[model samples]
Target: MAARMKRRDFIRRTALVGAGLLILRDPKSAWSYQANNRLNIAAIGAGGQGGGLVNIFAGMGENIVALCDVDDRRAAETYKRFPNAKRYKDFRRMLDELANSIDAVTVATPDHTHAVASIAAMKLGKHVYCEKPLTWCIGEARAMRKAAIEHKVITQMGNQGTASDGLRQGVEIVRAGVLGQVREVHVWSNRPVWPQGVDRPKDTPPIPPDLDWDLWLGPAPYRPYHPAYLPFVWRGWCDFGTGALGDMGCHTLNLPVMALKLHRAIAEGKTVVVEAEHSGCNGESYPKWSIVRYHFPARAGMAPLTLVWYDGGKKPPQEVLSLIPGEVPGSGCLIVGEKGMLYAPGDYATRWQLLPADQFRDFRPPAPFLPRSPGHHREWVLACKGENITPMSNFVDYAAYLTEIVLLGNLAIRLGGRIEWDAATARVRGRPEAEPLVHRPYRKGWTL
Candidate 1:
C-alpha cells in the first residue's frame, strides 16, 4: 500500500491529478487550460509608454481585461487594439467597478500618480507592475513599499534592464570584489531632451475634446491645461514628473545599487548625506544642468563611498572621462575602485568593460550569483501566478529604495544645500523647512 500523504499534500496532489485528467481527455482542452491560467490584466494610462506595455504583456499571453487613460485621443491606438477590454478615464472608477475581475494591473501613469494607482491596486489584492522611478517623492516610495508588504501582492518596477544578463553579470562581478574596495561612482545622463529651467507656459490652451483634464491632474495641484505638459514633455515639470534623475537614474543606477547593496545599507539605518550644485532651479522645473552628490557611510564591511550624478548635458569632469578608451557616450556609469575601474556605457548598464585594459587583460568574472531573469515582464507575470520566482525589481526589494535615493537629489536641488538625512526617521536634519518637499501635498480626492 502507498504511504498516506498529509492532508495538505493530499489536497494539492489531488488538484494536480484533476488538472492532468482534464488535459489528457481532450488535446484542445490543454490549450483551454492555458487560457484559464492567464492573468486578467488591466492597464492605467493606456497611451505612450503605457500602450507599449499593454501590448507587450498581451503578446506574452496575459488577458488584457481593462484599460484606463485620461486622454482618449492619445490612447486611441491601444483602444483599437484591445476593443474587448473595458475602458475608462479615471483609474479610481475602473478599479472600483472591476475589483473582482482584475488579477493584476500595470501602472504607467505620470510619476506623481504611480504610488496612488499602485497602492490602490495592491490594497485590492491585485498584483501591480509600475513604471520606474516608482513614485514622485520619498514618502510615496516608502508608502509603496509598506503597502506591498501589508497586502502580500506581487509587484515589479519597470526598470527593464534588471532582466539583462549582461547587467546581472556586471553586478556579480562588482560584488565579487574584482574592483577591490570601491570608493566612488559617477553616473551621467544626457536628458532634458525636453525643456527645463524655464517658466511655465503662459498659454492656457483649450482642453482637447478627447481629454479629461480633471482626471489628468489626478493628485496634482490644479494647473490650466497646456500642450507643453502633454504628449511626453511632462518630464521637465516639478509637479508631474521627476526630471532627469528620476527619469533615468533607475536604469543607470541599477547596476551599482544592486552590486553595492546600497538599499540594504539605507534600510539598516546608515547615514546618507546629500548635497547639490546646479546651474539654478526656479522651483518650477529642474535646472538645465546640475550635479548632485550622495555620501554614504560604511556598511556591511564595505568601505564608505560617494555617488555623484549629472544630468541635462552635464557630465563627469574631463579628467575622469579620460579613463575611458575613446569618446565617452552620452550616458554612462563609472565605478572607481582601488584596484581598477568598471565602466559601463549606456543607460541600461547592459555592456561594460574594465578600464586600464592592459592591467587585467585576462580577468575572469566571478560565477553568477544572482538568478538570471527570464524576462522583466515574464518575471512579474510568473510571480503573479504564485511561482517560486521573485522579480528583481520588486517594490520592497529594490524599486522603493531606488526611488527614494533618486528623489533625494531632487530635494537637494530644491533646497540648494547639503541636507543631512536620517533614513530611520525619514527626516532632513537641521532643515525642517525642506521637509515638505520630501512629501508633497496632494490635491483633493487622492491619497497614498
Candidate 2:
C-alpha cells in the first residue's frame, strides 16, 4: 500500500433544541489516556485539510492511533507522516476496530459525512473535532447537537476563526453596543472557486483503483464517479457539497452571526424567512452566483435583522462597500448598526474595523469578556485533556445551530424561493417538498 500510494496528503429529524447551549466544560470523560494527560486521537480523513488537522493534533503531542480515508492517493501525505498509524478504507471499520485504543477523533471529512462520523464517535464517548458547516442538512445538524449533549463529550467544530482574539473582540464589540442595534448585515464570499451551475456529467469514468468508490460516497445517494466531484471540487455538487454559501458562509458570516446572535434568534421564531436569488438553478449543482437573504426576528434585546449572503461573483451593494476605504476585498463582512458598522475584512473575522473611521477616530473597544482561545485546534486538544479551557465552536453551544442556519440558504436555493423554517419542529414551514433537502435520503449502507 505504501508503494502504491501518492504523496502528500445523515438524516434524523429530532426535536431541535432551542439555542443549544450547555455547560462548556465537563471533566467526565473516562478515556484510558487521561491518566497521562494525553488522548489517543484518530483522524477520519487524513489528507488535504484532514492531513493538516492530523498534523496539528500530532504536533500538540496527542497520539495518532489510526487513519481512515477512501482514497490512498489523497491520503499519502498523512500516511508518510504517521506511518505507524493503522489505516482503513472506511471510518466505521477504523472506529470499530480501534474504538478502545482511541480516546478522541477529528473528522475532517466532506460536509455530508460529518454528522454520521462525529455522532458515531460520540456514541462511544470519543471527543470529536469535526470540520465546519457541521453537517450536510439541518436535521443532521440538530442530531449532532443532541448527540453531543447526550454523550457529554468535548466537541469543537473546525471554524478556526472562533479562536482568534480579533474575532472574539469583534463579537464583544457588537454585543457591547459599539455597533448599536445592528439591524442589517451584509456578508460576501469569493467561493465556488470550484465547478458549479451545471448538470451532472454523463460520462462514467472508471474509478481509480486507489479510491474506494462506495465508501467515498458515504451517506449521500450514489452517483457515477467523476473527477469534477473529487479532490475538493465537490463543493459545487448538490448531492455532495453545500455550495459557496455553505463553503464560506460559516467563515464570512461567522462575525455577524456570532456578534448579532443569529443562531439564538432562530429559536425565537419558526417563521424565519429565507429567500435567495441566483444566476440559475439546477437539480444537480448550485448556481454560478447567488444572493441568499435571511429575515431574523428580534431577539436577545436586539432589533430585527436581514442578513444577506453573496457568493460566486456576487457581492454586497456598492453602498455597503463605500464605508471601507480603498479597493473592495474579495470576501468580507459588514455589520450595519445604528451607531456604525463593524467591518471584518476576511473569512475568519480575525481583523475588524469600526466603519466611518472619522466618527470613532478615538473609539475604544470594550474590554474582552470572552476567554481568548489557545489557538483553534489547541482548544479542542486542551478540552480533550480535561483542561479548564473550552473551544468556542463546540457543537452544543455554537457549531450545530450555526450550521443549520447556514444550510438553510441551500434549501432556499434548491427551491429557488423563500421557505419558512420551524426551528422548534426541525422542519420547513408548510413545505413538504422541501423536507427532503432538510433531512436527506441516504444510500443503502448509510444511516444517520
Most TM-score-accurate candidate: 2
TM-score each candidate: 0.92, 0.93
How much is the lDDT of residue 316 in candidate 1?
A: 92
- What is the Cα-based TM-score of model 2? 0.93
Model 1 whole-model lDDT (C-alpha atoms): 0.83
Per-residue lDDT over 1-448 for candidate 2, one digit per residue giving the tens place of the 0 to 100 score: 1112121101112321222344453336622233445568889899899999998888888778899999999999899999999999889988888876888898988888888899999998788999988999988988898888787788998889888899988988888888779788998888989989999999999999999988889988888898988989888898888999998888888878887888886655445789999988877899999999999888778898899999987888877777788787888988999988888887999898888889989988877777777899988877666555567788877888789889989999998778888887877877899888988887887885
**lDDT, each prediction:** 0.83, 0.82
Off by over 4 Å in 1: 1-36
Clashing residue pairs, backbone N/CA/C < 3 A, model 1: none
